[model samples]
Target: MAPGSSAFKEVVESHPKQMNHKTLKMKAESGTVKTSMSLAEKHSIHGVHELLQCPTCAGSMYPPIHQCPNGHTLCANCKIVHKCCPTCRFELGNIRCLALEKVAESMELPCRYQSLGCQDLFPYYDKAKHEKHCPFRPYTCPYASSECCVTGDIPFLVAHLKEDHSVDMHDGCTFNHRYVKSNPHEVENATWMLTVFNCFGRQFCLHFEAFLLGTAPAYMAFVRFMGEDSDARKFNYTLEVGAFGRKLMWQGVPRSIRDSHRKVRDSQDGLIIPRNLALYFSAGSGQELKLRVTGRIWKV
Candidate 1:
């Protein structure tokens, strides 16, 4: 292979192969070589790939690649936040690198999440869509009794919840729980309990919390499935709280843990009781709250 431009020379040195590439040459009327390439080598592919990277962010460049008068190039997004070329400090203008864009159109690349277990390859244009719905994407920890930021696959998260969060683990679809508070007025906007149930070869989380619903202090309880939204739709749960023949019931489908606990709580999709009603159900001291909550889960 013969030496071309500075970038082409680097490509030749890196990839030394003997394969004929498609002819990519151009000539102007004045006999001045606008573009010349005799890419009869295999080593130039990686060098061309490096040329598509934005010098500023080091990310792959797509369409509308901009350049400065000095020939320094950057992606369109970097061009917005910068007034001059990052390499040569030359004032930037609306100069598009059409040649590089054409090269990118001919290449295919792997997903950025390839290290995260996504073994898929796509054209430069189709990479983003595949990553959005990738099954191998990590899920956030569903433990809602605290501010936790752990994320991993489902099995790792289940183990983490039991060890790090000290969450209760049960083994049945039906459950009965009793919540007792000496000072109901002192309850703040916080989660009180989170229990996990292993049922039907899957897992579910039960959440109980106390928060201010508008100006009134209230209690809420709900269940969430430890899976995706589509699988969550295959089950239903009901919660009941009552005393002295008076009861409150809430029936709904379980939301997937994909929705954060705060999101589900803010939507108020659960059994809710005002402070006064809860105290009446306690049937004890005026300053005490002893509420019993029972729930059952089944496939629909």
Candidate 2:
């Protein structure tokens, strides 16, 4: 499509298939995108549904997206694997479904985080990306893998840890606690215990585990916030591990969610102690490791 005076002008030139859509793009370009709820008063939802589905993947197709020259539609990802439409086999040029998109622009879409109790209504085109890292998305208990695959929001997870797991909760950002991996000989990459701390009106997860970072029996402890990564930037946390003055400190903006706790340990985003240092801390008294980990979180 050629670049037009305004964003919607380009839409007008590219997507004028129906009478209503002839200048709809131009109007929308001039800041007149309507809501599906508003349009529902006049247009039928069925009209929007008929063209919203991608024939190849059956997923919802957003507008200004791709379609075949014959007008058979597919989501952008599905169209990547082939140059021709699956149904009509028409050469997949850069033809766009302008009218379909115009309708889509008006639709009130639900958040993908709806299952987690997020009720935000976004435009059809913005919902998927918005919900991926939405703060209200369902979260697993940060403690460990549990038979209780029960999901909850941040507050629910906080209560679950406090009551069910008996996790210790501290206020403010600074913490001076001793995290003990009593069974370092267990040799399984398992979490010993997880604690929670609150600071900057936000909650952070403190994960303590006995794992093998690189074949040496090691202990790792890290912190993660209970929100999206964007929210994580509101505060930064620092964890220091030391006993004999040889301290290892890590300061980073916590992740909203722990994609992989192991990945954080592997990347050494926290205070990681190998057998040598761990043994020094233990001082051959036993097969356990006691790390005096102190941390503080502050607003940015």
Q: Estimate each model's TM-score.
A: 0.78, 0.64
Candidate 1 versus the native: TM-score?
0.78
lDDT of 1 by residue, 186-284 (tens): 657753567788777678888887888988899999999887777788889998999999999999999988899989999998899988899999898
Instruction: Compute the lDDT of residue 287 as modeled in candidate 2.
Output: 68
TM-score between model 2 and native: 0.64
Return the top candidate by TM-score. Answer: 1
Residue ranges of candidate 2 with Cα displaced over 4 Å: 1-43, 54-58, 62-123, 133-136, 146-149, 181-183
Tell me how far the alpha carbon of residue 237 in candidate 1 is from the true structure, in angstroms, after superposition: 0.9
lDDT of 2 by residue, 1-300 (tens): 111101110000111112231110001111213433455643655566656888788788865578787777788888788888898987888887777788887766655565555555666667667666556667776666545566677778899878886676766557776655555566566445666776555678877667776677777777887765666777777877766557778888787554555555667777677767766765557666566767777768
Which candidate has the top score in lDDT? Answer: 1
lDDT of 1: 0.75
Q: Give the backbone clash total of model 2.
A: 1
Model 1 weakest lDDT span, ten residues long:
5-14
